[model samples]
Target: MALYNAAALIPSGLLSVVFSLASIFNALNARVFFGEKIAVRVVLAGLLGVSGLILLLWDSLTVSFDPDTVRGIGWALLGTMIFSWGNIASRRNSATRTAPIIANAWGMGIGAGVLLVLALATRQPLVVPTDPTYLAALLYLAVFASVIGFTTYLMLVSQIGSAQAGYATVVFPVVALVISTFFEGYAWTATAVIGIALTLLGDAVMFGRFGRKRAGKILKLT
Candidate 1:
């Protein structure tokens, strides 16, 4: 709902930038909910990430104070906050021995049901997508984005913390841009190159120590 409204009222790139708030929201949620310490590296990495994302999509960014735009920002920020809370929930689930696979399966199933109900209630006609590209994208998002992505992210949250695992959301755009470069001939600007670099540096800083700590835990468990 939030993303749909945002897409209607704002550019996709702008919507994505709004969504990037998930990183900071996750860190704050962790600190509040789980009493996790907010590290300086996490803060620095978030700064770099927001800056890099803005630069990378600077061409797509926009500013407006229209009512619809305001509403879109509100909706997008709501989505980000919900997503951040979900990360903490996933962490809690993992801590409680709920396997990621199980959690993701139930989540998707329930979410699908809810969407169907909403569609019916709202009198939205069900339409099958006939476009091949649309079908392919649907398949990719359902399988890779939802199932595999959510499962792996849940595992990461378990290993590290919800805060660090949330960087996945922050770094996702660079992956899309990389694919665009290869397949869609995305043009690179100086800002883009620097932006990608900063985003990566942020992820490395955010994950470096926690990654090693997770490895050590794995060794000990083994």
Candidate 2:
């Protein structure tokens, strides 16, 4: 819904930043609902990750007070918060011993059903794409992007808690750029390099890989 509403109204960079805020939301939600301690590293790493995103997107970034832009930002952020909450819900379900694969399957199925109902309500025609290229892209997204991505992410949440797993959301943009550089011929810039460094540093801090002892001191699990 966020992308549907805002993709044309705002820069892709802005949308990515908004969506990447799942880390902070997940940490807060976990702290409230599960009594998980709010590790300082979680917040600090999130800040670093957001800074990296800004730099990475600096060339194409935009700022405006226009109503359309503001509305788009709002929608994107609202959707991201909802997604963050969903992540915590999945974690809770995992805690109750539900398998991540099964949980993910049900979630996707139910979401698709809801979308189908909404399309019918809006009188939108549901037409299957026949183009081979489109079909191939859809298959890649369904298998590699959705099924594998969500299953592994939910497993991470179950293992390390949602606060930590949430940073995976922040790190994904950098991963995408890396993949694009190989397959899509993306060019790198000095600014983007520094941004990637910061993002990696943030991940290290979040995962206790920065300086094993120091990160352990800073990132306490509660």
Candidate 3:
């Protein structure tokens, strides 16, 4: 997923920096917070993942950044930290807490409230589309991505385990690329194609079939 829109999301120099740091933090947290042992193979997997990300980001090196880009990067980092902490907390606390459904309900409520406050404080309009096409898009987002996706993912985590459930995110980039190709006529440079291929292939090696096998090894006992 990071490979798909990463061209637009990050400036090239910052891609490896952000990814490496975030992943290091997450890996460290897995050891410290979750008491999960990091194996040699896992470390190799991480290296491969980073290599793939670098390949994916090779094109964005020439782009320059503005204030908006800086601000977006800051927000992205903040969100990454929050999400990392949340994942650790969820794994540690899930056994004693309510199911993911209840947790998500509370999370969504809090998230909406936070967004509302931020909008008000920033004096920004909570823009709603007047067009029927946008209205339909909103409805689809609300019903599918916001609701069904959330609930179903939680259920999948409970049943299949979080590792397998998390892999679904890897597919979104392909979806986004397809959409971009059709709507925006996204031209694929050779480098860009290689990046996508590396991203997908590395992601598969890290989290697709091999990931499922690894997860199964642990989950079988559960």
Candidate 4:
């Protein structure tokens, strides 16, 4: 979480790319820890997802040799690694019959406590927003983003393992763009359209929806 906060300070599309790479780490870690075989289709799907992410953020992919930006990128990469470990941990906990809600509760509670201690040690001001708009945004994030999102994701981790569940990060940008078109009046370019298509294709490949017989054959090979 600290790494993620630090990465948010970087001003480049590099973080997006780094975050996409988390899926790779998630997949590799799952293989290492769970003894899961890495199918060729999974590799292809991950590559496609990464390619789509890069294409989606192509316009913002500027090179900055500044020290801070480079440091932030490093922080983002580290955060991605930690995030992947969290995913694997979640999977492990779920396999042990731990309830998702209980796990999330303890995780978030510990994280909040740590942040509070850090804030106090650093003498940081804790300001509560009184603005109605800000309050509403906070409510939405607390309910939908934090509660519902984590629950659903942890459930997915339990059902499908961490590697496939990690694809959610890859798919979120496409969903965000679709929502932005309605809410933020975001205009879609041809490049974005191509990226969206590729992202969907990647998802399809990952899920092995090309054909049941072929998917079975591929699974057997793995």
Q: Order of candidates by lDDT, top first?
A: 2, 1, 4, 3
Kindly list the per-residue Cα lDDT of model 3 for residues 76-171, writing each as its tens digit: 556555554555555544666657767677778887898799779989988777999999998998889877777676665555433333434434
Better of 1 and 3 by lDDT: 1
Prediction 3 global C-alpha lDDT: 0.57
**Stretch of 10 with least lDDT, candidate 2:** 213-222
Model 1 spans with C-alpha error above 4 angstroms: 209-222
Residue 211, model 2, lDDT: 35
Name the candidate that leads on lDDT.
2
Per-prediction TM-score: 0.88, 0.90, 0.66, 0.88
Worst 10 residues of 1 by lDDT: 210-219
lDDT for model 1 comes to 0.83
Off by over 4 Å in 4: 211-222
Q: Which pairs in model 1 have colliding backbones? A: none
The candidate that achieves the highest TM-score relative to the unseen native structure: 2
lDDT head-to-head 1 vs 4, winner = 1
